[model samples]
Target: MNGKETYDKLKEMAFGEGIDLFRIADADCFLDSEYEGNRPQDFLEDVRSVIIIGSVVPNGVVDPLPKGRSQYTNTLMAATALLRVASFKLARFIERTGHWASIVPNEGSEFGYWYADKDTLRADLSVKWAAYCAGMGNYGINQLLITPEYGPRVRLTAILTDMVLDYDGKSMPLISDACGDCRRCIQVCPVQAIHEDGTFERFKCKEYMFSELGGLRCGLCLKVCPPGSGNP
Candidate 1:
């Protein structure tokens, strides 16, 4: 298939497999602001395009805050799994077409904690940034991609391919301070980690998760986000 044909097919495959959103971005988007020591070129030297795929996080599964732990974890895990399988499938298809494809890990890295900034948890190949670059969404004050449909309630995975596809060139406008003087996420945070400004204390939040949630992820902030929280 030609480049456009291949791109269309991949989008079909992703949506058929339950992907909530799919987008393509030029790999040059990461040339300047890569996380840690990893760059987009590091994944595939010949990479010309990045495929971004994401799935929605069910609001019902995260609405009750801490009480929804089991459901939330299951939903997140399933989203991650689907993204991985889709990435592998797309990568194999690209290889069969005589091109190179590199599937970035759905989870940033095994040692993500090591690089998690004390100010805000960030790791290599940040899926959030990739999604933004792909015109998928923009960042909220809480530092997560806020899609117009799902807000921050989404999980994303990326695929790097050598096939040159048309780039979207940051089509989505910046969300810039969409929280609109609202501080629900900050107010609901049990650990007081989120500041009034657009940043948060990553260490305090992580500690709260480890101690109270028994996991590295706590949905308190996500639970209170108006855009994605399913709240009226």
Candidate 2:
């Protein structure tokens, strides 16, 4: 199949499998000087497409927040697990079609945290930025991709492949102008890691989740997000 044909087939398969969002981005999107994360090309030889596939973490799972962190964390992991299976199957299909495919770590992946830079606490690449580049959403002040449909409660996995596909460039600002003056996430953050200026203290967040919380994922920022919280 050609690029468009492959793109359509993959997208259909993803949605048919209950994945909520599916968008492909040209691997060169990472080459933009503004993107600071690891480049897709470095991860795979001649990587031509970054297939971003994800599903929204159910609002039911997010409502408890910092109160039930264990439940929240487990649900997030469950979501991640589902993505892994789907992406694995998709990758296998791609390879069967004569292209190489690989899956990147998503939320709740210890591999991502383990391989991350110690000082920066950043993974090999920013999956949120990859999602944004794919035109799936804009970044919120909390630094999570805020899709118009799901807001910040989305879980994403990236698939690197040599299949060239039709995709869009970044059409919105790096950060959404729509979240103006909204401090819900900052106010909800226990560690005060999020700042008004849109930057966050990754170490503080990491320490809070892994150290203070005993490895439970903090969903305060996600829980308080306006668009997806059903409170706005």
Candidate 3:
């Protein structure tokens, strides 16, 4: 089957399970060259297309502490579960078509520096950015992918396949500057990690996550994001 037909079939599968699939040509997609090198052969072997999926976290699930566990961590875990299912389904579909499909996680590849070298790491595109590039959504000021339906409250997962697929090329207006005059996310940051310019200080956020007492994590940014606040 051609790229467009393969993509259509995959879309139907996703819809059957109530998941959304967005497609973009693997070659045309731009990733962080620093983490993901320009050498396509290194990370992806004959990757014809990339399938991006978004999972919306349910509202009212954000809590600093619930009983003894952190609610934010629970939500992330839930999102991870959703991604796993979707990716596996897509992989199987692609394999059935006689093409190799691999579900690569956002984290570094399985192979050490040799197969998935550090350069590939630098070139690795941010999950949110990849989703946006795939025409799945737009970029939010907090560096999160904001879907029209889910806002910045979604987790992204991807599937790489040799199966050719129709490209969406639909670029959404970036909202990276949406914080324009508003700094709600910054003002509400418990660790004060969010900068006035809407840029996040990763070190500050990481420290907060690593040093939090009782091991409870915080998703202040995710919680404060107004998009997924209401049910769709």
Candidate 4:
């Protein structure tokens, strides 16, 4: 099969496997001079595309936040778990198609993320960037990928592959167009971690979750990200 054919098969498999969101991002998007984060080429020199997959974090999960945080944390873990399993199958399928594939870890929004660089707290490469390039969603003021279907209430993972799949989409503005001057996320943040300028202090958010919340994930920034529209 060709690039488009392979992409369709992979999309079918991903969506059939219960992945609520799927997109193919031309790996070239990672080479942008503006993206200072790690690159997929660093891990796979021949990488040509990225498969972005995810499931929405049901509104139910976010509604009880700042209260049932333990449950909220576990629910996010559950979504990550689902993504990992589906990603494994997708990676194998891509490899069987005569191409190499690497699954990017979905460590964001987890408790005590072991895979992230401790000092920087970033994943090996930005799956969120790949997702953005694939047009799955756009960034919010809170620095979370806000999908039209679920706003920032989504969990995502990605597969870096050498297969030259048809790039289904192109990158847009770093932040969502709908993210106007709404600073609700910044206001609700207990640690003042989120900023109005679309930047944030990772350590501040991390410390608040780890030090004060006793390791339960904080969802305040997520809670006020005006669902779907991205503005309050």
Candidate 5:
């Protein structure tokens, strides 16, 4: 099947399984790795499209907890489960149709087949960013993708495939700035990691995550987010 047909089939399968899948050409930011030498070509030789999937974590699943317990972990696990199943099904479908496909987990030593560079030490840009680039949702001030219906409460996964897919390029530009100059997330940040320029201090965020603050990996920014403020 052609790109569009392939994308349609994937989308149908994803939605059928309660997941949202967005299709974009490999040119999207997620697929481009020129800045970090993490290009997609290093992995799948015939990669023609990326299937970005997003699962909204219900607000109820985001309870703030002490250091040892993480609601983020729980939400991520839930999202991962959905993505894994959907990805497996999609991969099988593609293989049955005579194309190569694979499901790349968000966490791993390599991005598909590309090995990490020693000096850079950068994992693929956050999967959320990939979903954003695929036109799945808007990027919130908290550096999270905020969907119109789910706000900043979502997890993302990606599937790499050789199947060419039609590009929607239908991004929600109007959903820009759900934060809206509001520094609630910044204000709530105990470490003041969020800067006025919209940049975050990675070191500071990391410190809080590992510190004895007795919080679940510092999800204050996420918990305070009014959007998607329910159980996952």
Candidate 6:
């Protein structure tokens, strides 16, 4: 199949496998980043396209968070695991087409994350940025990818491929500058990790998560965000 045909097939397969959102971004999407140490090309030298896939977090799982943390942790774990499986499946499919494909590590980065100095808490291959480039969604004030369909209640993972695919530019727009100025997350936050401005204090957020929340996951902001709550 040709590039467009192949991309359509892959997108169809992703949605068929329960991916909520999908898009193809030209490899150059990461070229303009100020930091060059971990661009998409850095991982796969021949990569010509980036595939982004997302899954929504169910409202049922998030609504019960204040009562306990197990539901949130379990739901996130399950969703991320599904995303990894989807990435692996997609990569294998791309390889079958005589192209090289690499799945980004979901949990940790190959390059160590420097939290204090750089505020890099998680992994390399910023799937959030990739999703934004693909036009899947934009970052909200809370520093989470907010989709029109699901607000911040979604998780994403990506695949880097050498197979040339049609770039769709951006299919989705930013949900809004602020989530209707709800500010529930900013108000509920015990440590004041989120600010009125889009800037987030990740270090404080991390410390609060570890010290107070027992390291499961503190999604109070995610819970109160109105966009993904089926309101929008």
Question: How many residue pairs clash in all the candidates, one count each?
Answer: 0, 0, 14, 0, 15, 0
- lDDT per residue for candidate 5 within 69-176, as digits (tens), equals 455655656676887888889889988998888665653111211232334434443455555556677766666666666666566667777776776564565235
Taken over the whole model, the C-alpha lDDT of each candidate is 0.73, 0.80, 0.59, 0.81, 0.61, 0.73
Candidate 3 structure quality by residue, lDDT tens digits, 1-232: 7766777788877767656545564545654352342434457758766678766666666533333235656666676677778789989988987888877564211111112334332324344555666677775555556666665666666777776777776466666434456566676667887776546665555556657633345555655565324447
Q: Rank the candidates by TM-score, best first.
A: 4, 2, 6, 1, 3, 5
Please report, as a residue range, the 10-residue window in candidate 3 with the lowest summed lDDT: 107-116
TM-score of candidate 1 to 2 decimals: 0.84
The better candidate by lDDT, 4 or 5, is 4
RMSD of 5: 4.6
Give the best candidate by lDDT.
4
lDDT comparing candidate 5 with the true structure = 0.61
lDDT of 2 at 47: 86
Candidate 1 lDDT over residue span 91-199, tens digit each: 9988998888888766521123444544545554666676787778887666677776776778888888889986665666555456887778788888887777656
Cα TM-score of candidate 5: 0.75
| Candidate 6 per-residue C-alpha lDDT over 155-201 given as tens digits, one digit per residue, 9 for 90 to 100 | 77788888889886765554455576578878987789888776677
lDDT for 228 (candidate 4) = 37
TM-score of each: 0.84, 0.92, 0.77, 0.92, 0.75, 0.85
Looking at model 1, report the run of 10 residues with the lowest lDDT sum.
108-117
Candidate 2: minimum summed lDDT over ten consecutive residues — where?
A: 106-115
Name model 5 segments beyond 4 Å from true. Answer: 20-22, 28-37, 63-72, 107-121, 170-175, 211-215, 226-232
List RMSD in Å for every model shown.
3.6, 2.3, 5.0, 2.4, 4.6, 3.7
Which is the better candidate, 4 or 6, if ranked by lDDT?
A: 4
lDDT of 4: 0.81
Pairs with backbone N, CA or C atoms under 3 Å apart (clashes), candidate 4: none
